[model samples]
Structures are given as C-alpha cells and as structure tokens.
Target: MIKHRLFWPTASLLALLLGNFIANPGFFAIELRDGHLYGSLIDILRNGAPLILIALGMTLVIATGGIDLSVGSVAAISAAIACLQISKLGDQNSISGMLGAMGIALALSLVLGAWNGLLVAVFGIQPIVATLILMVSGRGLAQLITEGQIITINSDPYKAIGAGFVVALPLAILIALTVFVLISLVVRKSALGLLLESVGGNPEASRLAGVQSRRLIWLTYLLCGLFAGLAGLMLSSNVSSADGNALGLWMELDAILAVVIGGTMLTGGRFSFGGTLIGALLIQTLTTTVYRLGIPPETTLLFKAVVVMAVCLAQSPAFRRKVLGRRKPKPPAQASQTQTKVEIPA
Candidate 1:
C-alpha cells in the first residue's frame, strides 16, 4: 500500500536531492546564525512555498475532477490589490495596514472563487472553458488595478510576512505549512476526503449517495482561490512590489504539474499531500540546479522539458511495461508433458 501510494514520487525527490548534494556538498549543509537557520534546503522550502500553496489547492480542485486555469491570474490580482492597498495607506509600513490589505485581498479572492464556482456549478459550463474565460481576462483586470504599472513599497511589516524568519524557519514556509496542516486535518480527519473522492470518482453516483457535489465542487475552487491569494501576497511581499504583468506567470501550469507528479490523477479522485510536497520540492530543486549549473537561457527550457518528460514517463504504467518488459507466460501443461515423455524415450 505504501509503495502503491507514493513510491515513484518520493524516490524521484530523494534522487534529485541526492544529485544536488553530489553537485554541491553544501546543498544539504545547514548553519545557525542569530537564531535563524540558513542553507540551500531552507532556501528551496522558502522559494517554493508559493508553489506549494498553489499546488495544495490544486490537489483539491483536481480531486473533484476540475481545473483552475485562472489561479495564476487570481494570484496576480491578489498581489495587485494588496500592494495598492498598502501603498495607499497613511502608514504604509504599519502592521495594521498590512493586515487590512491582506484581509481585502483574501476577500477579493473569495469573490473571484465564487464567480468561478457560479460559472461551473450553476451555469453548468465545462470547468476548463469556464476557468479559461477568467484566465484570459484576469491579467487585464490586474493591469487595471495596478494602472498598467508596477506598485512598489518599502514596508518592513509586510516584508516580514514573506521574508522574515520565525524560530529559524522562513515565515512563508511556516504559513504554507500551517495551511497544509489545516487542510490535511479537515480533509483527512473528517469525512470530507471520502466525499471529495466520491465526487471525483463519479459525480452522479456521489449525488445519489447524498454528497452535495455542487457545493463541494464550488467550495474547492473557492479554497483554491484563497490559497492563490495568500501565495500572491507572499510573492509580492518578498519583492516588495506588485508587477501584475509578470507576477504569477505560468504558475498554474507548474501547480498542475506538481499535482500530477505528486500522484494525483488528472482524471481526478484520490490525492496525496505528501506526494504534492515532494513534487514541489523536486521542481524547485531542478530549477535551482539549472541556475547553479549556469545553463544558458535558450537551452534551460529544453533541459527542464526533457526532465519533466522523464518524470511523467516514469509515472506511466504503460511506459514502464514497455521499458522493463512484461513477465513471460508459463508453458502449457500439454507442452510440458510432451517434452518430458520425449526426453524419457530419448
């Protein structure tokens, strides 16, 4: 069962980590300084926190047999709104102001989520088509919010949310881990996980079984939006600026890949947070490796694509069978008997 659940992804992650360590012995080295832990592994967790959050939410949505192409756009918009709010405040660096901005950003995310849920759940539009509508238009909305320009700020309190350390761990990592724990508790410690699996396995059957498929589906998208919103804040806060045009570009694709590599089927059903976490780490490690190796920009993408293809094929049963060869069938009883009789006569 353990092997069935997360063998490939976990092994892949460990292999990547080992490779990184081989390339640089310092990769796994950790040191303490003034009550803070610092290292390459810590950097990976901090830098990958946003992707972890996005993928965490994506897991739930995909579990319900749906996709959210608009998550990247939602992230952009959330960053724009939060930055705009912070920049407008009289005390821009105040913790109160930052908190307020965060609240407003999260509220907007909920609204955006509801809009998506309405399009798919109420209007009965296909999930991909519905999300595509916002995915295409959300950037424009973000652009308008930022007035077609980047909004920069120098707020220490806001910066702390993304870049600060708590108990020697990054604040962003803490936030992401907190959310991960809460979600795991809610989904696993209750009946919610089974219900989501049911809905994804067969919506009609789930509905017949009295699972509120529409409500659950809608809620999953909303949660996804909320997670994206938090990620946007962490992103903008890290840089202390909001660049709507560039912010969160193609992150949805990364999130989906993380979900897929984490052992979550694109067709939907069972999901694994542990696998998602490992997948996110593996991706971040790969990106770090490319930079560390000084790979040229033109060739970097190709390298990544090849690696991703390998991982996908590794997860494919058909590919494994083709590569590893299938088991040979046993000889027929009649053939064995004839061979024995002939050998005795000889």
Candidate 2:
C-alpha cells in the first residue's frame, strides 16, 4: 500500500527532471566556488527549504484531520518580532546582542503557538475557524510590531541564517533537514505518530482508547506554529528586512500544497514526512524549470494548480481503481466454451 501511494509522485518527479535535463543540459551542473554551492539545483534546494519546514509541521497537523490556515501569518508575525528586536539593537549593537534577540524571538513564537493551541483544544473551537482568527489578525499584529514600516537591518549573523551556506550547501536546507529528522523521530519512533493517526482516523475511538485527543491537537498546532516561526526567521534573514505585509503572503497555500502533493490527505489521517520533503523539492524544481524556460511568472501559479490537481486525482482511490480495473483479465473463448459444454453435460 505504501509503495502504491508513493509511485505516482516519484514517477512524476523523475520525469520532470528528465525532461528538464533534456531541455537544458546545464540544469544539473553543480559548481562549488569560494566554498558555496552555486547551481540551478542548489538554488531550488535553498528556496524550497522554508516551504519544506512549514510542510513538516503541516503534515503533523493534517495527520490529525486538521488544517492550519494561519501559518503564513504566523511566519509574518515571527519575522516582524525577530526583525523588530534586531532593529532595536540598531546597526552598531546588532552583533553584540544576537543571543538576546534570538532568545526573545523564539519565546514570542512559542507563545503564539500556545495561543493557537488553546483556542483549538481547550476552547473546543474548530481548527479552521480558530486558526482563521489568527490568519486575519496575526498580520495586523505583525504590522503593529513594525508600526506598519519595513525594518531593514545589516546584521551579519542574521544573514548567515538564511543566505549563508555550510560546505557548499544552503543553511536553510540544513535547518529543514534537522527539523525533519527531529519530528520524524518524535512521530515515527515515539507513540505520537500512532496517536495522531488514531485521532485522525477515528477521534471517538482514540478518545475511548485513552488517547488525549485534545492535547494532541493542541500540541500539533503548537509545533506547526514553531516551525512557521523558524521559517519566518529564515526568510527575513535572507532579505535582512521584515515586511510583514509581504513576508509570508500566500505561503499557507504553498505549505498545504506541499503536504497534499506529498501524499498526505487534506481530509487528514495518514501522513508522510519524507514524502512532504519530496513534494517541496518537486514544487521548487517545477518553479525553477518554469523560469528556466522563460515562461511568465504569473503562469507558474496556474501550473502549480494543474500539478496539484493531477496529484490529487492520481492519489484518489476511485481514480486508481478505475485505471487498474481496465487491466483486469477477461476469460478466454476456449475456457467459456469448455464451461458451457460441462454445464450441458451435467
């Protein structure tokens, strides 16, 4: 079943790469210059890292049959908070106060995550509605943090978090991998993954089995918020500016797309973290291919929509059964004749 589930996306990705390579022979060239990886492939990995991080959290949240519509706003809010702190340190003191700024930004992100959890778990609010409140207000809060102004800073340490590379690989990819492994350990190796699946598959049954469904739901959202926070920091670090209005706009959709394309159902129940990573890479590669082909940027969204539809259809049970049913065998004419003869003799 797992093999069946993974086949389509894997095949599609391979085909995409093959097509790109055929079109542009230079697509696969990886050049290491001055201790930094420079190549079209590296660029995709770097740009896709933030979405991968967000999708990791989204996978957990979706596994429990819940959706988080507020992640984009959370990212914006996190960026605003981190950049505001850096701005306060001013250009001269930014380097001297790096630790303090990071600590405070992390704390604020946790608090935001906790708030989302409380609303959904304790208050018995629907995940969509509960997160919607934040989706709308979080950006306003972020704007308030920056007083509706874009705070730009020239901090070396902050830049390293996003744009810097270690051993010719992007730092963002490293961070994404770390988060992925950590979450995979907790969910797959620990009881959390099973518990989440139970809740998603049948909440009442999970509750009857003594699983703390509410608490799990809350924790999932909280973790998702934490990831969004990290993603926000990475994004802002890349630009060295916090533009709350634009930092993570529409990113929630992208994260959700990655989760769905990775074979995690939007209706939620089962999820695949590794699959989510592949999905993120696939989306990034498609975007890069589009640009390399000289297609208009506006058309990329349409292409994404098409790919998403294709994936969803391919994953659907009805579609699979329909496609497979056509391959079923038909009885041979000789076998039918023999059966008729036997029936007549009897």
Candidate 3:
C-alpha cells in the first residue's frame, strides 16, 4: 500500500508526530482536565482547526480543477463583518447578537462565493485571475468594514466557538470534524465524487456526458467560501478581536499547500479527505516542532521550507526515480532444453 495516495501523507504525519515526541516527550501525552482532554496533540487539533476547515474547502475546489486564492481574504471579510456587527450591537455579549453577527458574516460569505462563481463559471474567467480579483480587493473590503481598525468583542458564548469544549474535545475540532463527515458523506456516498473527478479530469468530456459543469464548479467555490467564513469565525472567536490587515494573511497559500501535500494533484482529478486531514495535522505538528525545538523565530520559515520541499520531492514519482534510481527489468528466461546456448545472428 506504499503506492496508495494516503500512505505517504499518513507516514509523514506519523513521522512528524514521532519527531515531536523526541523533542518533547509530553507531545504525545494527553491528560484529563475539567472533563476534557488536554495535551499538545489536542492543542494541534485546536489550533489547526481553522486550517483544517479551509483545507477541506480547498480540497473540493481543487477537485474541480479550480483554486480559490481568495479564501484568505474571504476569511478576513467574514471576521470583519461578524466583528463589526457585534461592535455596533447594544449587547455584544448577548447570544442573540452573536448569532445575528454570525448570520451576517455567513450571508456575506455566500455573496462573495457567488461573486467568484460568477466570474469563473459564468463569465468564463480563469479561476486564478478571477479569484485574484477578490484576493486583492477583499482585504480592502474588510478594512472598510472595520474602518481601518481592529474590532474587538467580549462575549463568552462567542469565545466558546473557538475555545469551548464538547465531549472532552475542543469545540473547534468538533465543528471541523462534523463538517468533514458531512462533506465526506455527501461526496463519497453517492456518484458526486465520480462526477467531480470526471469534470476535473476532462471538463469537455463531462459536459458532453450531460454533467452540469458550471453548476458543479460554482457550487465548489460557494462551499469554499462557506468554510473560509467558518474558519474566520473560529479565528476571531479565539482572539476576540479581528485585525483586518493581519487576519488570515497568506492562509490561502497554506490551504493550497495542505491540499497538495494531501496527495490532491494540482491539476485536479482525484482527492482524499483523509489525506487532507493528515496533511493539516502534519503542518501544525511542524509548527509546534519548530517552537519545541527552540529554533530561531527568523529561521522558522526556512526550516519549514526545507521540510515542505522534502515532502514534495518524496511524493513526486519522477523525483523518486531520479534520486533513488529506477530498477532494471529482468531478462527473459532461457529454455531448460539443449537449445539454451543458441544465439541470435548479428
């Protein structure tokens, strides 16, 4: 099963975990506290929730032979909208106000998703350029919403979205897990997965075969925005503040990296949710390792770059052959009879 798509990502995740364990023995230790599990491993799940959610959405987008570079900006806008709503409310701490703010954020997310869909699916704009339009302008929209200021809120229920515990696990983790399961069911339980692969593998073929290619692609972008909004909510809730400028900066890149490392081809065709999940975890583990090992803050990026490059090479069949050398084919066997010594004429 070494050739299996999930195998390498899974192995990488385990290797990262093992490295963490070596650097800090407590990395794998989980303890009970207030009826909840607590540990570095749990922390990884908690902190990585936003990336996990975004990566799930990215997986779908990539599966349709498209990329959403605006996911990060969508996240910023989501946080801005939610935080702005709450800041203007009479009771910022009220659960009703928080819910209303969340609703507004999600509504705006749908609009943004539709906007991207319109540009790409309807207008026939290239996915990268279409998404780049929002990628640049969305942060400006977020800045406008917050009036070039960081919006902060003080609400326990709101904070609970990012920090609370449910069934002895982080709420963010639970939310991500629920989304993953639902999407997995929707995509894998039916022919949707095949249709998506067909479209990505060959849009013209899929279209000729009666697949509504535009609708499918549009829907993928919509879902990507939806999940980015959710991730924004989790991030703002965690900090109780929304920094339009800094929030979700470069998150799209991270999501893309996670998607690639998960064995989803950049060209798009097939994908693995399990691999994506492990890839997200691997990234978080790498970050944690950097800090645990006391690596210089300035060099962290370089270190991550090296590790990520190694992973990419490991996953590349051509790179593997180049580095490890290909095996030679076996020669044909000779007959056991007396004619074995016969040679071909020159």
Q: Regarding lDDT, does 2 or 3 come out ahead?
A: 3
Cα error of candidate 1 at position 342, Å: 36
Residue runs of model 3 more than 4 Å from their true location after superposition: 328-346
Candidate 2 error regions (>4 Å)? 1-3, 90-96, 323-346
Question: What is candidate 2's lDDT per residue for 1-346, written digit by digit as tens?
Answer: 5347677777777778888999989978998899898988888888888899888988888998988888888899888888888877756246657657766776777777788889888998888998899999998998998899999988888888889888789998899999998889878998889899999989999999999998998899889988998999989999999998999898888888888878888777888998898888888788788888887878888887887788778877777679878554667767444443445555
Which of the numbered candidates is closest to the native, going by highest lDDT? 3
Better of 2 and 3 by TM-score: 3
Please identify model 1 stretches exceeding 4 Å from their true place: 1-3, 328-346
What lDDT tens digits, residue by residue, belong to model 1 across residues 100-196? 9999999998898888888888888998999999888998999999999999998999998889999999999999999999999999999999999
State every prediction's TM-score relative to the real structure.
Answer: 0.93, 0.90, 0.93
- The worst-scoring run of ten residues by lDDT in candidate 2 lies at 335-344
Q: Quote model 2's TM-score.
A: 0.90
Model 3: per-residue Cα lDDT over 124-150, one tens digit each: 999999999999999999998888999
Question: Between the candidate structures 1 and 2, which one is better when assessed by TM-score?
Answer: 1
Q: Give lDDT per model, in order.
A: 0.90, 0.85, 0.90
